[model samples]
Target: MSQHHISEVPVEQREIGMLAKHREHIIDQIDELVKRTKYLELLNECQRHGLLSPGMCQNIKEYTPGRRNENEEDLLLERHRQLFKKLTQRGPRAYETIISVLESLDCKEAANVLLSVDSGSFVSLREANKSRRPGMTVVDEGVTTEGLVLSKVSKESKYQYLNPNEPLVPYTKPVQNSKRIVKKSDKCHEDAVTGTYPMCSQYNRGVLFMVNIIDFPNPGVIRNGAFKDGEELIHLFREIGFTIFPYINLNKEQYMRILKELTSSQYVENTECFVMVLMTHGNRVNQIDRAEFHDGSIAMVQTEIIAHFQASNCRKLANKPKILMFPFCRGPEPDKGVETDGRSAASPKPTAQPKRNIPTLSDSLVCYASTEGFETLRDPDTGSWYIQKFCDVMAEYAHNTSFEDILKKTQSLVQNMRTATGHLQTGNYKNIGFNKKLYFNPGFYK
Candidate 1:
């Protein structure tokens, strides 16, 4: 009977009711909770669930004006007290959010303390939130079994918040360069007829060139958990019948030299599609991005990377899909997003087809971590939200979905996410001159 303890209030209202009924007891336990809490990890979990309001997380991280001189641990405990109090005010949904976070973080003792705040039977945090999502068996507050499977079951970025004053490079019209060379898509028509970018198993070895920068010169700039993203990318892309060419921390000059090698006759002639992923800290001055490297923390301009693949430079890959995914900050502004419902959006109309008069940068899709002028978020534990979602979406959908649709799904998933303090981020893409239904028919060739 005790195990089956039931509440009189409606399911949606039970957690709130329980929380209110035990408010003081829960409040009393704050000291204990603070003592055991892993504050930063808890902060991330709260952000992941959007439990805290905009800027609340930041407020908790720093001391109020006069208290900066206090002992660090003492200040952190006080901060935890403030966070719990705020969550209590935010009502039961926030209560459920924190409880779930606690459980996921394996702080069971802390979790149970909140669950039984009144020293009486309390509503299960899992039971409280399950009514909202029918198919889900609420294991954690906001996370579902399905989510864990979708997230870990699939496996996936690393970055810091460095938003530069950058604009999304929209490809509205073909560049009018008289000196541009014309590479005909004549040879790519057969591949297009099949409806996906032709991916030959023979060319799988050169399929993706992942330049992951883990070791930065300065200790402050080193991306800690980003290596996880690289590992996942290799496994996921390789499963898609694409070969993975992973390059670790390289000097600034080595970046182009490697790309130049891949553009060698062996790769150039058999290449089906070109995929390049640049994971690093980006500093923007004007439209150019300074991608970091090891030896000197060398800076490389964003465009040169693209120019290296231009029809003029990499002739064979000009007509194929040239995908460049940058999981780094593009601007200095953090996106404090608006509240909105999830709705189906028609795939963003493709960039108007560039007149193939001379192989004008067609078929190039540049995916940025966030929208123009906004900072993107990254979890020091998992990876960049944008890259993680992108890989996850692809891992699930690439078999039959078009390239454009995949990007939209990735964008939607990334956009709906808000940070612990409620900052929003959006991933976006630019379609270069190439306009055709691109697919990576995983296992079809294998």
Candidate 2:
């Protein structure tokens, strides 16, 4: 390990080459450098010096929260690791630029932290041939008959889906070498940026409670392609690290029970976010926002649905993102097609701190497939335009963009969408209690 010291490194390899080899050491010292430096300011200084590329900046920004875990001690270690990895991939002057940037930012300790790494040392490798676990395979449709006694019907059933809450091989000890290897670990800002909520991938990512209503008793229209929407949604959110619990054709009692279970579940307690997606027929009755259940009973969106995750009722989800998506009608009318006079489409992003004393419903977002008084259009073969777009945008941009911005993009796509009759359907949302930004950080930990 002593042979890898920075003092013994060749001058030519000092900053650039040694960076790649010594990255683990750099990560090892993360707790130190971050203890003395302002991480974002470091990024800014690096960018200002033309040392960090825009893509790198966006990647780091998206991976690390803008606000959460910002304290000196609890600093995000991966942020520095990512920056170092990018720097190593850079050209000749990468070393001088970062060192200068560190000095300019009054982060001499951070600079020294880099310069002090023992580059000659290499971490021990994990056993290349460890016993394989019985892993369950995930498919696009989400329903799998593989991996267990029940799966004897198919070759895919040889393994079982591992529950994360359950300990994996209880006798196996976790590998704990900070100076082992450079671990692997997105974009920002055409729109206004806000403070990002901390999304920890160390444990649970988030919980998704989805109810897809395709069947209703009596004269109600059986929502065609609704299951497609639900299937797509389940697939999409699982990528976001959500523990998906999906229900189909639930009556009012069962729907209410789902809500009750979610609110009272231990999963929400440690989750970074809680999302509820409802695909069913809905309409405004006496100015109340309501949607139909399997039995055709109406659910009060605000009181019954949103109220469940409010800080007052579910304290466990307090200060966390509670995203409620209603891909259904809110009123009886459709948004008539509007002729835009012209087609078109930058500001320096502003970073704002989340204000205190917000509201009982803080940290929640409500997404409506169509604006009030408009009918949400759905395709018999596909699904609703709003939800399909929502899935698409999130899949493409959630890595580097804020959830709010993703929603905005989804809405923008929905606004121009015309039904078969040439009527416009616009997606809208209520941004309640969101003073900060939210990044999905898809597949970061995995």
Candidate 3:
């Protein structure tokens, strides 16, 4: 062979005019093949052959073992022969006419003819080849046996075929991230105490209520001393101006009632934000006690109770910052401690069962004591790692920083503490994002 060095063309500016022209030509050929008159004639022929109207052909030309290299002309001719044989044997006038029409087109014209005819009918010729029978091949004039035409049918075309799901255009716009501003009417009160109140109300100056659900009925004298640490948390929130509501040994119904009242629009509307603290024994999915307990447990407050409140009454809080501090074990036991460690041994059974019906809140922050599939640890002397750090960070940062900033500080503190104590597994839960921005002043400065 003579040495033939072909010049490589830049794909971006390569000559596609020929391809475009060929495409247009093929399209025109298809247009002529699918003329209404031709379709009517085919339909008449099919009717004469005792066949119904000539419906759209789903798989006209397919690549097979022997037909892999077949061009449009060859395929069209093959289809004509197949249809003719079937029509003659079955007596479908429409099939006979369609075969005759298809036979008249050459390879270069066959694709356009079929496309135009189907385009006129309810069938879309541009739809994905997957929708057609397997082995079906779509080719342009220049498309070789190895080349394939990717067809995509529009919804409008599908609708013409009686597909209700298909539409001419997308009914919904693309979802885009947009900034949201959270509005509040309250101002921080100078008389409010520090370190106890949630920072959300400091900037907004709203009434705050802190509810602590402690399931401990009675701890041994030594354990009892440590359990009293939770009482300090209660006192802190109260001194900071929050109305303290402690639900001790509360059942499902009682918990629901309290949550209903707290989240009710009637009450929540008067406040700039809401804060809920759940301190109880929990497993991976449920909150349980020694005996039987509520299926959803503390989480029910958001999903079932709060959902009810928001849906029926408290639409105002729908967009407000609803903060939930969940300090509970979420999963199986932690690893055994080293001999050098002097901490108490792990309990035989989990302290509590998982809450089954916990609900998800749309516009809120859920601060878990531990990450998913991990257990939450309590100091017995300082409450839970999550709660202590959370309260401490809020008290330290509430006066000068935003709620978002406080969360960041809390997360850092928890990570540091976990690392320092050799409990690297005790890291903070993932940050719960919000759709809107929230700013808070803890009232420590004011």
| Whole-model lDDT per candidate | 0.57, 0.58, 0.38
Where model 1 places Cα greater than 4 Å from the true spot, the runs are 1-196, 200-206, 296-300, 339-356
In candidate 1, what residue range of length 10 has the lowest lDDT sum? 9-18
Model 1 / residue 2 / CA error / Å: 45
Tens digit per residue, CA lDDT, model 1, 44-148:
666555554223355456534256578776777777787776455433344555667788899989988877754444345555546443221111111221111
Candidate number that wins on lDDT, 1 or 3? 1
Tens digits of per-residue lDDT, candidate 3, 129-226, equal 23333221111011111111222211111111111222222112211221211222245423222222334443333434333333221110011111
**RMSD of each predicted structure:** 15.6, 27.3, 29.2
